[model samples]
Target: MDMLDFGSPRQTYDIRVEYSLLYECALGIGAFTWDEVHDKLDIGQAQVLQIKRQMSEALRREVSLAGLHHTWRSVLFLIHRCPYLPSTTQEKHLPVFMDWLKEIKDSIRTEAAPYLGASYQAPLAAALAGNALDMQKLLDEHHENPVIYQNLQYLFAVSAEQLLDHIKRLVEGWYEEVVSRDRNVVATLEQSAAQTSALSQNVSHEKLIHTVTRGGEFVAEPGVTTLWLIPQVSYRPFTIRNHLPGYAVYYYPVDPDAQTGLDKNRLISNIAAKHKAVGDVLRVRLLELLAASSRSLAELAQAIGASKPSTHHHLLLLRTAGLVHVDGGVYGLNVDEVLALGEELCRLLKLDGVKAAQETSQGR
Candidate 1:
């Protein structure tokens, strides 16, 4: 089945400029690598091999297994879902690439069957095991807010080295495998010649010089040839810059030499204490939900996908933390203290902005 045939694909998130990534990798943005892309296509075949083993067991339609995969298609489906994860922290995209190979398994079932045999999944799985990109996390859940830079800042948890290495390998491999092989030069030269002919007739863009190639030199080869894949990159200026310095402001860090680090634990604890009385994802979700609408314990549980007992525990924490107030059967922002909460959040955001600005200035 075509994965994209379901309709316009679901709204999935993307961390970077996805097309740029595809251009760099030589595969579609969501495609797997050269060696491993076919391997994912074979994992299903491996599953079929397993299914073939159990065919003689007529008494059972299913064989119990870890992860409880009941059939080959289900296994394929699971792999297909692997690329829909929430984080992209893999040190290398090569490792979990097999996870993406799930998509091509269908292609392997037909035209690619010869190359994608039983041994195919082995390399694919190996690539997955070695991949640095989290096959389960980074696939489609990247941040999408217009504040793209803030979304990047949210990824500060990731190390810079991992990002750099993945991009470097991806771009280099793409250039070697897909880009350099194109014989665009001859085509371009020919097209340029065609233009040359047109131009010898005084056509536009004719240097009025026929060009020739001898000893690997295009000595103005006296002909019009269109150039193709001429590995030349240039950028046109968006605007002419006439630097008329209208204003300049000099700012210094409050303590340029001060060494400081944000203690995530303390930051969470402080925010929690100030807001939810406890800094936690659940409580934060609760605050957000409450801010929008008053809801009962059951509604809270359903909204947060937590068990009643779990939701209760969190509600208790929030109530005790004095961040929430319960009334009737609904829980929500303490109507009386809501203003204070807003003030606090605004102050915090402002403070963070100031600190960020200070750091940026100091870096200069």
Candidate 2:
């Protein structure tokens, strides 16, 4: 994999920022913790708790019926497959999204499965369960299993409208309350987009990525052509990265002017947090355990032979330091953040022995 260096031939990347209510709703209703949201955004504790409650109730009533994973899978599919047409009203995007789902269902039903093997449906089902967004690729990769096909077909029929309506309600009801008041969400995004566009025009892809990704990273490899810089209000202080075969998206946190006070001290504080997080023996062991596979809090505690509260304390520190992430109630290490910490340390110390000394002297 080739790293995109700061000095390179002008390879232009289309950088744009947009607000998605459905995307926010999807993430809000998914595996993310409300604590994470509160940690990053300027939202009140009571409001955060209320939003969490609303999300829980909505998921239980609507999304859970279709299986939360399946619903999220659909959400990802919608994001990746559906063309986000330019519109002032966010709800206008829903019809196109629904149409895409309908098309996928229609193709699977009418069009014969492409594979000739014993069971394409099994592979297809596994792919769907695995959150494979591409319908054709799912068909091509695995022999069709009737069970898988039927389950998906049923899911589409039963849950598609429910999922859309659920998103619609959340967007209208919850997202509005959280973001609509005095929040120039679109203006913030437009500013970010314009700034990004100008920066990209002048800077290399590598520098552009480093600036926007915060503590996170963007890997540019062969066939990874396009990059999306989407700003969101819900998932704050953390940039969620998603990659398909051809493209990748970085859902950046929308930090308003008031919350941007930490900019001057964020790097130093983050470095301190990272070092402190890894300085613990328990946290190191926890990372070792999570390296293999994601685990629940109970499993982590049991593996570490520590009490749940004790284990959670260490995990909280790691999470606060951006060394770990929770997905679907399971904790996983942010390998990129881990690697970036090492790079940051090296950048601080490894450049020159004399330079480090000179910086210390200059500070004095």
The number of the candidate with the highest lDDT is 2
Report the C-alpha displacement of residue 147, candidate 2, in angstroms.
21
User: In model 2, which runs have C-alpha deviations exceeding 4 angstroms?
Assistant: 1-17, 31-45, 53-60, 63-67, 87-91, 94-183, 258-364
Model 2's alpha-carbon lDDT is 0.58
Q: What tens digits encode model 2's per-residue C-alpha lDDT throughout 198-240? A: 7778876778778776656566655566887776655666677
RMSD (CA, Å), candidate 1 to true, equals 25.6
Q: What TM-score does candidate 2 reach?
A: 0.47
Clashes of each: 39, 9
For model 1, residues 1-364, the per-residue Cα lDDT tens digits are 6565556543221111111112212221112212234334322333223222212222122222101221222222222234532144322333344344434443322211111223344443332344434422322233343222222222232333433333334334434333332333223323433443343444222222112110122122212132211111000001001100121111111111111222233334445556645468988888889989889999999999999999988987666445566666577665434455566555656877888899999995
Please give the RMSD to the true structure for each candidate, in Å. 25.6, 15.6
Would you list the C-alpha lDDT of every candidate in the order shown?
Answer: 0.36, 0.58
